[model samples]
Target: MIALVGLGLGYMTPTVVFDTFGIVSDTTGGAVPSAYVLALVVMALTATSYGKLVSVFPSAGSAYTYVREAMHPNLGFMVGWSSLLDYLLLPMVNALIVKLYVEQVFPTVPSWLVVVVYTVCTTTLVAITMRGTSRVNLVLLAAAITVMAVFVVIASYQLLQGEGAGTLVSTRAFAGPETTLPLVLTGATVVCFSFIGFDAVTMYAEEAKTPRTLPRAIMLTVLLGGGIFLVAAYVTQLRFPTNAPFGEFTDDPLPQIGHLVGGPLFQALLVGAAFVATVASGLASHASVARMLLVMGRNGALPGRGLRWINPRTHTPVVNIIIVGAVCLLAVDFSLELISACINFGALVAFTFVNASVIAHFAVRRRELRTAGEWVRNAIVPGVATLMTVLLWTQLHSDALIAGGVWAAIGLTYLLVYTRGLRRPMASLEE
Candidate 1:
């Protein structure tokens, strides 16, 4: 349940949905659930591609790992570069979520201070004492889910008693006024942030009892995650059809919704759950990315002993952990909106290549698509998934496109220089 639920709906979905509801509502003209529906469809299709790829390359299989073996190493480096951007920003996003929860309670604490404390705590813990927190994280997940269930039940009760949207059964949440394809797609882009970690289960391909089970886990995680996301979006949309009543809280409606629906006690519980979830997610994302940086440094992709500096006593990458903490300080000035967009931008870039890797590995290179089923699984599914991901790309905000583009350009330039203008290959290539 944890390889990844610990990161999936158990962590990101509630936070993203509670955070993005207002954004999606404004963007989709009050049809947040509609956007979620679109995003879920896209993610489900992409999950199939992930399932296909991880089955073949089941050892610690990631987009970078799969594309490297199937396509070209240079291309895989580019995919890894893009994915690294997303991985790096996710911890910061969790910090921002912490800031929101802290701000909700304190109402006067500086956002910068909250982020600093959070960053320092998580970074220091991972560097000094990175022990198993799976049980603790699971307890937190249960607490959060319980709180959410209470909130939804209260919202449903109010709906029956004729409040807000005032009805339990209606298509208003899914197809409200002025909801168009572009608007919904734009909303989907924002909500896709919730599903970012659904594929993360594949990273544990090596640890899974069986290789076949790992890919299925990826697909199942996406589907189950989507179910939770849609239910939350649907109910919350009905309870608060638009962001008008939210006013300043439109940027973050979690606390405000709690108070409005069930008062301060419920509000505190909701914000508390947000804090627990963020801390769990923050620690996990921070350590994971820091170790990723350490690996890159050791492999010559990063070209620095600083990131490679392991603590003698703790045996963790102290330098890289601190570096990630410093990056998390970016949350002081960043909004959840822009950070999430940039992360999604990197995800889409990696996802597109992952789908291509499927075709390049099985359909094109293997040339074994004699049967209709093989052709559909290896070629057509991934082909359509690639298109779906590209469509989501068109919906990304301008700032994200620019940010991701610049990062990709830097990676491409670095690859060219490191490979002697593509004549040589990336470092550590024994193959």
Candidate 2:
């Protein structure tokens, strides 16, 4: 349950709910529902692959560990390096969402101030203890789920009363006159960002009471979270078919949707809930980033000893938490779209490798040891996931592709320099 909530709710922020509505509407010509359905299917396949890997190698390093054990250390380093783009930028994106939500409620508050407050608060909350962070996240997730449930009820009531599209049941959100296959695919690629944290459940495998249950938990997390995301997108599209009102709120649309359904008081409550959700997301992202850095530092893959230092009382990497907070301070200048694209790019790349890792581990190396069922579970399923993720990767925005490329190039450079032109290993093999 902890894995499910942490991975599912941690990524399904209110900002994601709104931003996806706008982005998918722009790309799919109002067929937001179909696009979300496509993304959900693709994510479900990817989640299946992650589950297989977790069952085989339940470790804290996530893709980094899976790829290294299955394939080679060099490729594993690249996968981990690519994942840094997602892990490092997620806290900033979450902080930006909080800033946007607060600014929406109190327009006079400066963006810089909001960013500072969010970063400081989130970093402090995360640096305290894992137990405390989990408690806070559970509370925030419950509140977010309640607010969304109310939203769905109110939106359904409004639709029944001849508002917006003037119909409670319509295919307009799933298919419009202008909707095309290419457009829906583009929207699906963008919507894939909302599913980023589903794989994060694997990071907690080492601590799980029964490692065998993690695979089922991963699938449930994706299914439950994806269902909520699809419903949110569907209802939001129904409420605002044209996507024009979203122009006023490029960062958030839930508050506006709340206003349309239940007036200003409800809108304020939704905004407050959204703020809490963003903070929860920031805490989760910050903790993941700190753990990744700590793992890499312990392996001597990172440069500094700072990331390796853990406080005895707290059992937390204080220096890495501080560093992540400092980086999040730069969130004030980044646009939501750019941040979304880059994050999706990095996550997609890492996911692609995870799929490949499964095939490499199960099919090629242990061909004689596996039954047909195991072969299908380990190879064929992940192969489909690889293909789907690669398709989405091709559909990423140009900015995202370029940014990811540059980040990858930098990682390659570090690997080459650190290993003296690829002649030596990147991390110690003793572990």
List candidate 2 segments past 4 Å from native: 368-371, 428-431
Per-candidate clashes, comma-separated: 0, 0
How much is 256 displaced in model 1, in angstroms? 0.7
Against the true structure, what is each candidate's TM-score?
0.94, 0.96
| Candidate 2 lowest-lDDT run of ten | 6-15
Task: Please estimate how well model 2 matches the true structure, expressed as its whole-model Cα lDDT.
Answer: 0.81
Q: Give the clashing pairs for model 2.
A: none
Using lDDT as the measure, the top candidate is: 2
Candidate 2 per-residue lDDT, tens place, 1-431, comes to 66455645665564477645766787899888898798888888888878878888877778888887789888888999899899889889888777777677788999999899888988988888976887787788778878888888888888878877877678888887789999998988888877787777777777789988888888888888888887877877787787676568744566676676788999887777777777777887888888888888888777998989999989899999999999899899998778888998989989999999888988888773367887678778888889988998899999999999999999999999998999987775334
